[model samples]
Target: MGNSSSSLKVCTDHQGGINWLSLSPDGQWLLTGSEDGTARLWSTADSQCRGHFQGHESYITFCHLENEAAFTCSADHTIRKWDVMTGQCLAVYRGHTSIVNRILVSKDYLFSGSYDRTARCWSVDKEKPIQEFRGHRNCVLTLALYSSQDLLQDSEEEESEEEKLSKDFLVTGSTDCTVKVWWVSSGRCHQTLLGHTGAILCLILDAPNRELFSGSTDYTIRTWNIVTGEQLRVFKEHQGSIICLELVNRRLYSGSTDRTVKCWLADTGERVRTFKTHKHSVSALKYHAGILFTGSGDACARAFNTKTGILQRVFRGHKLVINCIQIHNELLYTASHDGTLRIWDIRPLCKRGKRRLKKERSLQGRSSQKGSLSRLFNNKVGCVVHQEDGREQETVELM
Candidate 1:
């Protein structure tokens, strides 16, 4: 694969490092939070700054974008809602005594996790917090929400009166190495998941399957049944800290500080393949169609084929580590600690032609051989024979 920086567009107006990026639901606008204490809105079509949101007293830690509004949380110990088109601050939410790390907006309720070791639920129209979840002993790093309807339906057993009356469930993961499930209606923690020996860095919810996956500095990914808070499975192949995770079609993709990205069969906890092209820790991951896009500490973003574990393209130009990535309208957007947001057209790289077709056929042939051998030879010690490039090869193996 070759570097594709020539076709990249750079947006370098931010004076400080970008900490987070959020793409709007329609994919027409992008919002970025930075160390400069401001969040700006940009047009993805032309890479132009459409609105500049100001007024945060400290650097922004995270941001979320909606249809007509933007939400940003900062070290200023507050979260602010802004009108996306006009760039006007609509409301300021203040309650956290420390830095606000993440914000999630669901319906009319806004949920925020902070360094205060608390996650709070706030009314969108009101500036005050409606409920506070105060069990985590360390900074809250990630947040996810499960709808009330889904939670009720997924329970194999009858729900309690309190659970039936709950609005929704808010999930929080923290530096304390725990994941807490809270009822949004009562501000009470329903369950505390404890298994990771290190800080929880990221979380992704597989709601349809009633599962929650958490990645941690413990170098493992753990799955839990959200309904019962029962530990389901653990994926422990990574040699370093797990930084990010993406779930697509029951397949779990995890990026790690081991400088590799792994693909797993989500339901079975089976390791499918590994992509080892990254030169440094894989910090961010995004899955679109059949391609896996990654941002790494090497200051480069790469595209890989999920099926064959082949590197398709390399994006280089960022001067520092890439912090986040988003894909929209055939373009890939990357925000970096280098104080710039870069966008690249990924349409050309996504096309499958003669070369890719040939590779797929070769991979299929090898896969068939492996499947046949696995079914026929049940012995722990055996000689495995396979054909590659028209040559026969034999290898001795131990189970």
Candidate 2:
């Protein structure tokens, strides 16, 4: 297959490298956090800068949008909730003594994981934190949340509010090389999963199987039974630290500093295949609309066919490491350490083969003669009879 080239129609405004991004539920807007210590809202329809929230003193580490408000955590040691429509800081949660690296929002609680070796639970209705989970010896690196419906979906009876609140759990990965599952209602450590030789970097839940998958700096990914706190399997093929993990349609896709993304059979933890394209660490990944997209330190984001393990598209433009990616409404939003947020339209590739061919042919018609070295691929080859010097020169032929 010939390589397909495409360009984006919009590049949102940001001054510093984007650290994180979140898309609105309706796909009409996007929120991005940057090293510039500010977060901005952009209109996806026209790529206009709609609003800017600027009060943080340091890098904006993460951002999440919930309902009509948006929350952002920062190296400034605070998480601020902003009204999406008005660009006003509604409330500031300032309990973390160190940088808040991540945030998780539930129905009523907002959880913040920090470098202070603690995870604090906040009432979304109030500014003060309700409970503090402190157990890991090192800083918490990531947070994941799951419910009874996620772990015990086969139960026929509807769960009571008491049972639902009791069973709701918060999963945290820490630099202490352990995974802790905490009951949200009690703030008690339900289970402490240990076995990693290095720091835990990321984690995800296998909802249907009641399993938890964690990746660590130790270069191995472990699968655990959340209920029993038992180690189910360990995938040790990655040569470097695992950076990101994504689950789609029962398949586990992991990105690693080893410069590859691997798929696993979530149920059995069996390796399905590995796809390599990035020349540097695969720092971020998102699986959406049947395509698995990955971003890396190599300054590229790629879309791969998850089933066939084929690289279908490559997104380029960043000058530094790509920190994150989000896909919404067939649009791929990428955050780069190069200090920009790029919006790529994947619709060109989503069309049928005939339509793709038509576009390719049109691009070919306009792109021919723009470059000097690709005559072989750009035009048909032909022979010309020698006249004066008995030497045939290059001639174009119609296909």
Candidate 3:
């Protein structure tokens, strides 16, 4: 791998592998859930640990960060909310009978999917679940939220009675090879999408487009019409299980155990480009300012040009797989199974490369899109109910 170790900053405090990572909306803080049975908050400005949240009896599986609080789910079958500054445990959401796989926070509610084979919605102010989604036949591996407000914003025409009465929806993907859409207001199963033949691994929603993209162990990515329960498209180029998916500007990017990343046109299902530089499974993906950043089981993160399909830089140093990645303010944050969060100064290196690419494109008479590569300096799960013998088995869970 190409070396860029001189610009890297490592935060080594977690005792076990970091499973998940979340960035505060303001881009000032980062929250990481770890196999150490705790979650910690760090400052993005200085790479300093700001708060340490400890209370779970088992390893944390996932985490989400908000303005005032940090939420973490664990193998202990509980979800805890912590104050961002004080690190005090505020509330414990206890109801799942098995491991909680993922959590999503929207407006005033929290949604969780678990190995318990159900997804539940909770009021942020309450301790118990306000609604239980109980239809999945296997572990609920991933969760996503779509607000009806987005539909309202997308349409200027008069709303129908159904549209007027529609509440926000919660989408869950499971090991049962199914995707369920539930009404957040009534806890009713709005739609059950069936197509995949293997476990669903990751999900991403294009709310404005009313489309849902799901990556699966079946080695395919499928698109669905969330409102009509219709299968729209299937992208089946990956040679191994599809692990992660990212959508920006109607372009879809997927990483797989095939040790490659592929880009596709979301509307047309056309494969645009392939990035095959990774030596192991591509575990995570993040896109910022026209650059695609990928983390892999090879313990390295890399940056690639979206338009030209060029490998720009490779970040190496981690001793284990990188679990998740986040980019903000020209700094790249990578969480890994090495039990460390490493931040890289991506500013100096990428700026010069981006300028050169822009000049080349201009000379070729090529125009950039609204959020294309020419704009630089931009700052920006799994199922199964099987029980293990000794310690809980570690799996890849990303958000």
Best candidate (score: TM-score): 1
The TM-scores of all predictions, comma-separated, are 0.87, 0.83, 0.86
What lDDT does candidate 2 reach at residue 155?
54
Writing each residue's lDDT as its tens digit, candidate 2 over 1-399 gives: 224445475454678889988887777788899999999998878767888999899999999976488899999999999999999998899889999999988877899999999999998878878889989898998999988656755655564566555757889999999999987777878789989999999998877678899999999999998767889999888899999999876678889989999998776777888989789999998876556788999998888766577888888777899898887767778888777787788875555333544554565554444333344434455533234112111111110
Model 2: ten consecutive residues of lowest lDDT: 390-399
Which regions of candidate 2 deviate over 4 angstroms?
A: 1-6, 10-12, 152-165, 352-399
The RMSD of every model to the true structure, in order and in angstroms, is 6.7, 14.0, 12.7
User: Which stretches of model 3 miss by more than 4 angstroms?
Assistant: 1-4, 152-166, 353-399
lDDT winner between 1 and 3, please give it.
1
What does the lDDT read for residue 148 in candidate 3? 72
What Cα-based lDDT does every candidate model obtain?
A: 0.89, 0.82, 0.87
- Which scores higher on TM-score, 1 or 3? 1
Put down candidate 1 lDDT per residue, 1-399, tens digits, no spaces: 645654468899999999999999988899999999999999987889999999999999999999899999999999999999899999999989999999999989999999999999999988878999999999999999997687557456776787787769999999999999998888888899989999999999987788999999999999998988899999999999999999987889999999999999888899989999789999999987678999999999998877688888889889899999998877899999999999888887656533564665576677668756664664455544444312422111000
TM for candidate 2 is 0.83
Superposed Cα deviation of residue 113, candidate 1 (Å): 0.4
Evaluate model 1: give its TM-score.
0.87
**How accurate locally is residue 326 in candidate 1, as Cα lDDT from 0 to 100?**
94
Of the candidates numbered 2 and 3, which has the greater lDDT value? Answer: 3
